[model samples]
Target chain A: MKVAVVGAGSIGLLYAIRTQEAGHEVTLFVRREQQIELICNKGIQVEGESMMYDIHVKNIMDISGAFDLIIIATKQTHVKKIVELVKVNEIVAPLLFLQNGMGHIEDIHEIINPTAIGIIEHGARKLSDRTVAHTGVGVTRIAAVTMKQEDLIIYKQMLESSHFPYKLENDWFEVMSDKLIINAVINPLTSIFKVVNGEVVNNPNLFRIAKKLCEEACDALGKASVEYHLDRVKKVAMQTKDNHSSMLEDIKNGRRTEIEGISGYLLKRANDELPYTTFVYEGVQAMQQMDRREYE
Target chain B: MKVAVVGAGSIGLLYAIRTQEAGHEVTLFVRREQQIELICNKGIQVEGESMMYDIHVKNIMDISGAFDLIIIATKQTHVKKIVELVKVNEIVAPLLFLQNGMGHIEDIHEIINPTAIGIIEHGARKLSDRTVAHTGVGVTRIAAVTMKQEDLIIYKQMLESSHFPYKLENDWFEVMSDKLIINAVINPLTSIFKVVNGEVVNNPNLFRIAKKLCEEACDALGKASVEYHLDRVKKVAMQTKDNHSSMLEDIKNGRRTEIEGISGYLLKRANDELPYTTFVYEGVQAMQQMDRREYE
Candidate 1:
């Protein structure tokens, strides 16, 4: 399988390395001149607690090529631009979005063929543009929105052989909903509070806010509610005690956050009567606005 | 008139200088050894927008004579200590509390003769210890819980001669209630948001919170209500748009805030039905606790 890892961020780099280690030809599509140079010069270095690997890398926009799978692992705010870059470059493949937050599926469907699969790839950002540590081996579920079986099966075989946990779910909405719950619960709070994920455990106020926000999102989605979202959210915050959320990463790096696509979105999507959740969302939004003003 | 200004902070220095300029002998009480040495050697320099004056200063515990008016201008947390110092020094006159908030009256009453007057002196903090800009020429209202005619006349004459727009109110409780309303509305919000008194006008959410808190406080006092307390609170926030609240000053200086003395007192004093205000109080307390843990 020929895999093109678009954006070439920590997540993209990790995926490229795993796929290449499984004997698949992996190509890294990166925009920044420095990232391309570094990856090409040093290859992709992925160091986890127990595993380490280096894989092939390249600048996809510069090179002329097509691949079996194209993973969109850039920040959510960069999704539209990456999509435009892909469309303008005329690179066609089954694109996988591994960014945090929800509602990127519609954007992908609009830009490219509806042959994209969204994956909630959870790990840790070891550092900025340097190394990515696979903190925990979590199951990655993938499903075809508008793709056929042959392509799906071929990609599944490659993913399974890569030694990274991967699963297939026809109900990708459920998976996406689950991921949204976790991200909404952890990302904004950890980012806004400027604390590690685990600090939410001792901070009762933060824990309550996280749980309430998650329930709000679940209520907005109108799906079969899972009673365990709160526990799962708490567990994730506790498990990743030392790690900052992706939003916090953006804040630390002085980049735009995906707050609009997460809590901001939930507030707009949720009904007007949900004042408790909406109040929390609005408060988070105000804090985000403050950050934006401070940075600008 | 003989006057002693307790707590040689910016406000204390201002009162001492103005009293001295009005031809009264004024003594500023210092707490710390360094403050005492600094003030005694260099004099308390009251640098305002218009003029600068060096005030004659003395330590509170070092004073050997009584004063006609003792103005306490320390942060609310230091009130009890100042009262104790005043009691030990045997300076028994009308000790007017020049800080905002509603809890100091009881504390001062318990420690001193019931003749201590509660003052609501509002203005601005323009700089550090050396300077204070008088933004508004507001009246320094003094009401004696219990006082002889000689003491009352002396206190009133001292304030009037000092060019301070002051008046004596028969109902001290009403005057204190009005100031409490203002402080309950403005202090926590300005401190928590880290905004100036005026910036709350631009942030409607803050304005709403401030108004709601003030209304809750007014209801708690059960006073002859004025429609303008809300307007006055909003006007003050806008008027001192660039100035930090005393509570914010405490936070910035890493001093323990008067949370328990100000908004905390209002919340504790209000009936159980005003849970919304209680919620705001708890929120402020939570932030204060977090700040203590973070800063300390």
Candidate 2:
């Protein structure tokens, strides 16, 4: 199976390395020339609990060759860019998107391919240009957004391994909506408070705010199944207490956040039903804008 | 005239010294034995424009004898404590409350005496036990919460001076509400961002948040007169950009913030109408709690 992981971020790199380790040809589609050069010269470093090996994989700036799978591992903010690249290259392989929020699902609908949505539970951080720290090992849940049986079997063959497990689900909406509730609650609160995931749970007041946000997200999404999202959010926070959410890392690194996709998306769907969600969405947006201005 | 300034904080000390300089017998009623000893031995140091002097004034731990005017210059959190002290001491004089938020106005109503509310525009910071830096000189607005003509004349005589101007207003609610909106916008935003007052205006996103908060505050208070509060807030932020707000200073010093009096008060009145105010109010409250826990 030929697999290409778009976006050189931690998640992208993690999937590319793990897929290659599972006995498949993997190519990393990265935007930076420096990252491409570094990865090509020194290979890629995967450090942490799941793996600790440097593997060589093909790295490219353009989407040239056809592959069995093209994982869109970029942020939801960059999903449109990846879509543009895919359209320009006219690659028709199965497209699997691993993004934080539900906003990119609309964009994925427009792509002309056997599309799938993925929720990557693994906690990974990019250490350097060609190094990734797989902080935690969790299952990746993938579902057919618009899938074919042949494409699904190919993805399962390439993604499943003893160390990196991939579960196929029937309903992508349910999977992504659950993931959205979790991210919508944890990401903005941690980013605004500038605390680690654990602190959001450790501090009682912060935990209350997080719970309120989770409840608001559940209500906004109208998902009765995720009514207990507050507990799930706390569990995740405790499980990854030392880890900073991707949004917090983005703000810290002076990068554009996926707040527009997460909280901003919820705020738009909420209309006026969730005031707390709207307030938090606006606050995080302002913080992101301020951070971008400071970086510039 | 005998004037007593309770609570040996920056504002208390400033008013005490200024009254003394205006030829009134002034006494500072403080809580700490150390502050009493420091002030008795070395006097209070007032630094900044309009005056820089080491003036001698009587400092005592207990409320001794009767005073012509009693200025309650403590933080709003301590207003109830001061009220208790007044009840215990059975001191009967014209009481003047100088604190943030309108919550203290109800607390002042409990006191059985001629009372007035003051909005101190002077930006003062306590540098040491016996030193205060009067950072900026702005006119102090005084209005009768419950007062008599004789008491007002006495307060004017003691507090009004060429260096320290005191303007008396007929409507204390309007005066305090205006000041409340200003503090509600500036204090919490500055403390949460951990920035000086000026950055609240300099950052466009922060300024937008400030504007939104001002509008919410105006709506919550039902004050169409202050619809232009956004401009007022920006002007105040620009004027005091170099200085940290009292709330920001409190958070930095690990002291209890006046958030309960300002944003908390607004949140209570906003009920369900002002979601942004409630969100910011909760966030600042959590930060205060975190700071307290860390200090402990």
Candidate 3:
């Protein structure tokens, strides 16, 4: 299969290496000249629990052949642009978005036909530019859009044979909602408290606050069958004890965070009525202030 | 008149300078060897708005002369020990306390007799051991507990000629309550928000939250016939717009703050009944966490 990974972020590079290692030709779609130089010079290095390798890297404009699949691992804020660029450049393959938050896949589906799928797979960023330490050996759930069977089967086969576990679900909204609740709890609490993923376990008040936020997310989404979001948050936090949430990393790096995409999205969806979500929103704003002061 | 200033902190130093300028024999009581050395070597240099002067300084333990007036400007948390030291080692005069919040004067009164008067004055620090800067020229209000007519007349005359303004109040509770309201709004907000004093003016939400806390302080202390607490806060904040507030200075210097003496006092007095006070208590607690992270 011909796979093109967009954004060329750490997550994007990891996908490129894994897809290439699965006997597929992978091309990375990076925008910056410096990133293109670095990746093209060094190739894409994938460091996981058991293996490490580098794949041949390519820029989006330099690609020659059409891809059978385009996996977008960009941030939620950049999803619209990647979708537009791939559409304008005329690569009509099945695109799999594996980013945080919910409802963004609806935005993608509004632009294109029912070929895009949302994948919820756990991945960890181990370093700045070199590798993604794939810590969790979990199943990746890929849900096809509008009952697209052909795209679903091929993507599932590719993800499965790519040395990682994968699953296929016809109901994409369920997976998206579940992932959204998980993020609503974990991201904002860790970012606000400025703690590692594991510290929530020891701090009972903070853990209750995290659970309150998850309950708000669940109520806003109106999901009845979802598991308790706080339990999932604690389980995942225990699993990735040393990892800093990506939001916290953005704060430390003096970058604009995906708070707008995660907690801020829930705020917008609920029309700014949820108190817990608003608390998280205010906290992220404070984190932004702290970040600004750090660099200045 | 002979006066002794205990603690040698910024507030103590300012009071000592002004009292000495009023032609009273002033003796500053210091603790640290370095502080005693600097004061003895270079004298106590007080740089104010329109005046700079150096005066005599002395250690509390070596003091032999009797004083007609004693001013205690140590932190409120240590008021008991500070007063006990003064009582056990030296003669007790008409003591004046210029600390933050509401309890130190009463605590000292519990230890000694009701011979002490509480004063609320505006003063600030420039450095730890170098010079004390009187940022704002403000009157010191002293409420007498028990005083002779001759001593009151002389003390009033002394303060009047001192350069800094002076006022005498018959109601000690009112003056202390006014300062408590100022601290309720200024101290916790500046500490929690971790912003400069002027930032509260720009953020109305923060100002509103601060006003709620001021109301809580006013309600807890049933000293009647005063104007609204938040109005007093606005008046003081407007007066001291450029002042770096003692809480902000404590955070900058990594000192254990008087948050306990001010907000913590009101919060404990609230008896867990008022939700507004409880909210302010939690908010202040959260700010303490932020302060610890920033300082520690």
Candidate 4:
């Protein structure tokens, strides 16, 4: 199967390399010419505790070709731009979006192709332009946004391997919200405190704040009857203890964060009822702004 | 006039030296004998923009003998301990309590003698054990907490000078609350962001959070309707932009913050209705804990 992964970030690079390694024709769509040139010349490097390999794949600057599967592996903030690019280029394929929050779910409706959403439980970090550190491996859950089940089977079968596991779910909202709750609790707390995920639980005061944020998030999502548990959030934090959350990474790199999609989305849904959520959301936003200024 | 200033922190040293400079005999009551020895031998150095001078005021480890004016220039966290010392020592004098929050206001009730509360607007930094840098000079507002008008007049006359200006107010609660609202907004934000006070206003997102916090605080203090403006808070931040807030300084130095007296006090008074206040309060508490652990 031929696949094109948009955005050459950590997640995008990881998927692009892994999919190519699984005997599929993969092309990485990157923004910077330097990144494209670097990847094309040196290939992609994947380093981890158990695995270390490099895979050479075609890199592109234009979304001009049709593929069997199109993975939108950009941050949620860039999803809209990807959608616009795909629409203008008329690249019709089975679209799968791997983003961190629920805000991009609505944007999926704009895509006319069969669309699917994915949550990457694995932790991957970009070491350089063409290098990604596969920090941890976990099951990737994929669900249909507007895609037919029969259409997803081939893509799933093509992408899934013993090393790269994939699970399919019928309810994408639950998958996104479950991940949203976890991100909402861990991301901002770690970013605000400038600590690793583990510190949020190891530090008693931070643990309490995390618990309170989890409860507030759960209460806000209660109106939708979204299935969530504070324990599940804690469990995720514990599992990713040493990992810097994506939000924290964004702040460190002076990049815009997915806070608008995660906490900001929750704040919007909360509609003035979740005061704690509002406070955390605004506080993280302020920190992000400060981070950007420091880089400037 | 004979005055005894407790605590050898920046505020205590500033007041003690300034009072002595005004021709009044002042004694500094310090906890450690080292601080007393350092002050007694080196004297208290006041470094300012235009002038720098050292004044020798007797330092004592024990609180003995009656003082015409007793100024408690300790952090709010130490007020309870100071109150106990005063009670055990049975020193009956016109007591002036200089603290940052409203928590100590209730503790003032335990003192039987004439009591007054003060908010020091000046930005003073402790350069060393026997040295203080008067960063900025502002008016110190002194209000009678449980003191007679005539007694406050004499005490104010004794303490006021060209360098150390003092203003008298009828209500201490208003003065403390006014400062409380400012500290509640500025201190925690600066500490959390690890920025000087000016960043809280210069950064748009931080400024927004500051305004929101101020509004929430005003809402929480509904009955008294404390006279506070967000602009006043911003002005203070701008003026103290180069100086780390006392809370930030405390966090940086690995000392316990007066958060319990500022945001913690407001959180208690808010009665769980102020969710934003609770969130900010708990978030800062967690950061403080994290900071302490790093030093440990």
DockQ top scorer: 4
Give the poorly placed runs of model 4, Cα more than 4 Å off: A48-60, A223-228, A291-296, B48-61, B223-228, B291-296
Off by over 4 Å in 2: A48-60, A291-296, B48-60, B271-273, B291-296
> For residues A81-100, could you state the per-residue lDDT of candidate 2 as single tens digits?
78877788888888889988
- lDDT of candidate 4 at residue B193, scale 0 to 100: 75
DockQ of candidate 1 (2 decimals): 0.15
Write down the DockQ of candidate 2: 0.42
Q: Which ten residues in a row are the worst by lDDT in model 2 chain B? A: B52-61
For candidate 1, the TM-score is 0.75
lDDT scores of the candidates, listed in order? 0.66, 0.79, 0.67, 0.79
Model 1 lDDT tens row, B6-119: 776667767777777777888777777776666566565444445555666766668657666777878788887777766786666776777777677777767545364556
Q: Which of the two candidates, 1 or 2, achieves a greater TM-score against the reference?
A: 2
Interface RMSD of 4: 3.3
DockQ of each: 0.15, 0.42, 0.14, 0.55
Count clashing residue pairs per candidate.
4, 1, 0, 0
Arrange candidates by DockQ, descending. Answer: 4, 2, 1, 3
Give the winner by DockQ: 1 or 2: 2
Q: Each model's TM-score?
A: 0.75, 0.92, 0.76, 0.93
- Winner on DockQ (2 vs 4): 4
